[model samples]
Target: MTQQETHAQEAERRGSFSSRRVFILAAIGSAVGLGNIWRFPYVAYDNGGGAFMIPYLIALLTAGIPFLFLDYALGHRFRGSAPLSFARLRRGTEGLGWWQVGICFMIAIYYAAVIAWALRYTLFSVTEAWGDDAAGFFTGEFLQVSDPGVTAEIVPGVLVPLLIVWAAVVVVMVAGVQKGIGAVSVVFIPLLVITFGALVVRSLFLPGAADGLDALFTPDWGALAEPGVWGAAFGQIFFSLSIGFGIMITYSSYVHRDTDMTGSGLVVGFANSGFELLAGIGVFAALGFMAQAEGVAVDEVAQSGVGLAFIGFPAIISEAPWGAFIGVCFFASLVIAGLTSLVSVIEVVISAVRDKFELGRAQAAALVSIPAAVLSVLLFSSTSGLHVLDILDHFINQFGILLVAVVSMVVLAWVLKVLPLLQNHLNRNGSFRLGALWRILVSVVAPLALTYVLLDGLWNDVRTRYEDYPGWMLGVFGWGAAGLVIVFGFVAARLPWRKDTPMDVTDDEEVQA
Candidate 1:
């Protein structure tokens, strides 16, 4: 068959985004998530306050967007899911793609539970359900968290909402790309912005809002000299942007071949950062109000992750005027953001499975999401779920995602020597031209910065147990889970591709592009 015929066949087989606009919205939806809302504010505060923006922007420019462009180039040029793209890139590297799929698998399992929690919290905001003790309510009542050991006992509160989240995700995935993922993005992204923007506005009028802003934005110039601050900047950018994973690669593969990927990357990258800044403003303003109401310092109430969202925010909601509105907006934003990101994460697995096995979209969605939902509900609805989730998140992100990212970059740039080829593809149609600097950033600087962050995290984890959890708990959920992903990757790669799946870029295909 001619290369044009092959492209047409593949386009029919694998759905494309309806247009570049939908692709941008979908990409932005994936990039902006729970981290922007809860994590970035604290990372900024802890790193160097406002002064951290220097390194943050530097990391975004030099590392984050560059890596994002690399993912875009790979997916757009190859026009396949991660595994299929890597297989076409070079057969030996297919395992790297599966490695990413494995990471997403583990991530999706735990990530859904968090979204479930947020979903419940969104409803709870109406009545101020936590009453006076948000922390106790979250742990003792809601999660009913037990000791740090595995158990089959389930928490009804978490299980029901978790099922809801999984159900919604399956429907979206089965609906295929444009109608499901794209439609949700077009709707939810705007809703999220409106609700969260109102929440930020509400927060600014609260008493002591200025104090929170001051605490967050006050520059610690001396922090610029600290290597740890730079590391923190790069680490936050990496985690926040959703790069170095199969997500962007998979999403980009759905865009038309001639789409301006570089331009889209810039929009997504900047939009995510803009939202993070808005999050900082909103989160800290509420936190500052909490501190004033409790007659304490802003630092006393400041927290991140679950604590910030479920615990600290509840306390703020209980005190602030129009507090229920604030609570609903905040938690709803979490649900919206988390749901969008979770859909993208699950899609990586679905896309890879469909490509490798040549399954229909509905079949792939059901196969990938059902088992994931069952495992997610089973693991996270139990008393020990929190502990396991905590350990898995920490270890998997540090070892699984970051480690594989470094390895993928090395293989693609050094071993396979495909940087030039990808660059050519990007420059041919990209609005922003990529040249040698882009290559150096992807191959050298980004990896080196990531390596430092990875090694630093490794040394810390090795020196002492994460969160001082029992050794066995860390051993199983932490180290053992991370190791299993690598093993799963190589094993999955060994499985034969579907007979009809194209595994190579023919010479004719090269000329056609």
Candidate 2:
């Protein structure tokens, strides 16, 4: 069969999205997850209070949108393996494909840990397992990273449920994306949206919600005066967009060739970020009401704890009617959010493997999922073990992802130089070019910005050796980043560079034979 014929047959053989709506639903489900409700609110409040959104918007427009298109162009144009697309998009200016794959593999492992953590908390919340002084229960329990000096009392009620939570993640992941990821997302995404929206409306009616809104939106643009502010904005936007991780390439691979790239990226970006804004508003408003009631400041309570979902949110809900019900729904929403992203990470590797090796997606998925599950179980043994996952995340993100992105852009723009043609195909019967501004941004400006991010993140991480986090933790984390970079460079140096025929078609279309 011809390459196009093969893709058409595969599209028919595989369970294609029932419709465009389903495809869109799946996309939104993949993008809008725990990053929105759980992480964003906490990061927003802690970083700049209300002032953070200034650089955030700038980064969102410049850094986030342009890269969103970049990832989309590669994925839909080439469609199959993220690594293949990465290599193909650049046509081997360098072999940077391995770097992209490595980033996905590393994140696949650590992200499993995070999903397990969410699962642990979801069960705890459902059972009302936290005892009196829920805040103290969490603050005094397993969160050593939050309160290093305090002793973590082992509460069986909490610990046992956390284990069960880990099991749920394993089950969902092992089942594969088509059966597990797609099925769960179709149900959970809508339910999560309804539950979160309901809670946000309820939170607004609380005594001090107006104050909360002020705290999130009334940005002090003077935050722009600080270099760190811009850096934080850039970092968060990149992190939130999930562009560099190869997951975007994986998901978009399944997209239709003639799909509207500009519209699709915009919808996913806005929906994902918009919900985060809602989450921030609700969280801050609830905290504002809590502060008014307790006469304590909002900043005093915004610690990064898995326990916060179980403790803090319940406390906020406790004031309203159906407080327990609301708390349950909110935590459940987080559980849903966690699954979406978690499943996407798994799908990335499975999709890559299946396309490359002519393996079944189910078999490839098991190969990835089983190892990740075993790794998470073995890794999170010590109470301080969770911090290890953070180190791996940082090293992989900075070394693996940044390197691959730089190589890909250079290859496409300077080496193979067919990005313009592929992009033109994307724009046929369409509007909007990637334009010169984005060209400069990705080629010259973006790489420099990413380099600064790597150096700054690594330096700040290493500097922590002087702090109270124990010398060994700093040592492992510091050298880990450097080691990853060196290994990545070594491997990338060896890949062949040549002018190959551009296989620029969507997975639903055709990128290659």
Candidate 3:
């Protein structure tokens, strides 16, 4: 092939989002996921209600948006996915990219199953099938509740829905970036916003809704003194913005060369936080009504994570007027939220493999997803699946995700010394210029905070076997899972790159660009 023709082909291989708006939507889609809807509200309430916002906003500025912009600069300037982007930055740094992608892969395995639960519940919402005993129905009738640590048979009830979730994810991924991830984000992001917006509005009209809002916004100023509350705020901002995973870096890799990285980062970050605020309104409003019906305080019925969604919310829906319709909207919104994020998680792994092996989009999706699907079923298809999911999720986030972020920050800012160049790229292309303050926030403040959290987590794990689970269980699943990803990362980094891959594309191309 002619040299110019070869250059065009290479550009085609590195896909671009159809437009800036589509890229923004896809980025926002990845950011606004299950965490914003299912986890944030409860975390806020538990961490001193309105007072949490103080540290949350501080973390957003110092850590969240700064890290987000740094990731964007790496992808857009380099024009490569995580593995290629990091490798382009420095030769030996490729392992960190693989590590982040591996973490995303592990997360995608269980995330699909969680979305499957939301999908099943959406249908059940029509019939109010959960009935009065929502907890019993969830644990016994729905999941069949096998004992923890038991090697139970697969529950068809869970497997069938999970299959549907993975199928949806595969279809979108097969369609490729702009036509698939971008198009779906355009549809799903707006739909999610509308559905949740309507739910929030409707919730405001419910009895005792005022009490829920009060609990959400009413500050316990004294609780702000607790160091744990500050840590909680930072943790919420860190996880909710989706910065630690390879998702942002991969999504940004598809953007046009001139795309505004700083503006985009601010928009995605604020949109994520805003969605969580809206969710808090809806969740607590529903919980307030539940508390009133049960003749107790909102705290009595209020919960977080799976318990809040499957148990508390379902019971609230069963008692509300037009219960079935409300339930359908709530769970449908949940499904959309989860699916949007799930695709991004799957894409991180697929993109990494595709870049390294030079595979076609469909081939890459199938290669990565087949194994992910099997792993999903193995871990989450049984009655004891929730226990398994909880352990993997805890260990992965605590050690896997957080550790990757800590190392990435130090590597980028200190070792590679690329922050200044990235800042220049963001300022030159973006409407708002990043100054010295942005550099300080990323190079110093963010790393220090992340290091503190990592140390604190290590200390806690040493002192107590997380949740008082047996040491063997933590050893096999918790630390073992973390170790597996680290091993895979190094192995993948050592794999041979595609032969046709340009030295410029794979090496120090971004530095020249």
Instruction: Give the per-residue lDDT digits (tens) of candidate 1, residues 1-513.
Output: 866777778778888789999999998999899999999999999999999999999999999999999999888878788898888888888899999999999999999999999999999999999999999999999999998889999999999999999999999999999999999999999999999999999999999999999999999999999999999999999999998879999999999877898999999999999999999999999988988898999889899998899899998999999999999999999999999999999999999999899689999999999999999999999998999999999999999989999999998888988888888888877899999999999999999999999999999999987899999988889999999989999999999998877655553335122
Clashing pairs in 2: 77-505
Off by over 4 Å in 2: 9-18, 46-51, 90-95, 133-136, 139-180, 304-311, 314-321, 397-403, 429-433, 466-468, 474-478, 481-513
Q: Could you give the candidate ranking by lDDT, starting with the highest?
A: 1, 3, 2
Model-by-model lDDT, in order?
0.92, 0.63, 0.85
Per-residue lDDT tens digits for candidate 2, residues 293-412, read 677766665544354565677666655555666666677777677667766766766665555555555577677766766555555533544566555665666566665666666666
Worst 10 residues of 2 by lDDT: 146-155
TM-score, candidate number 2: 0.83
Q: What lDDT tens digits, residue by residue, belong to model 3 across residues 223-297?
A: 889877777777778888778678888988888777788888898999999998899999999888888888999
From the highest TM-score down, the ranking of the candidates is 1, 3, 2
Clashes of 3: 0
Of 1 and 3, the candidate ranking higher by TM-score: 1
TM-scores for every predicted model: 0.98, 0.83, 0.97
TM-score of 1: 0.98
Best by TM-score: 1
State in Å the error of residue 332, model 1. Answer: 0.3
Off by over 4 Å in 1: 506-513
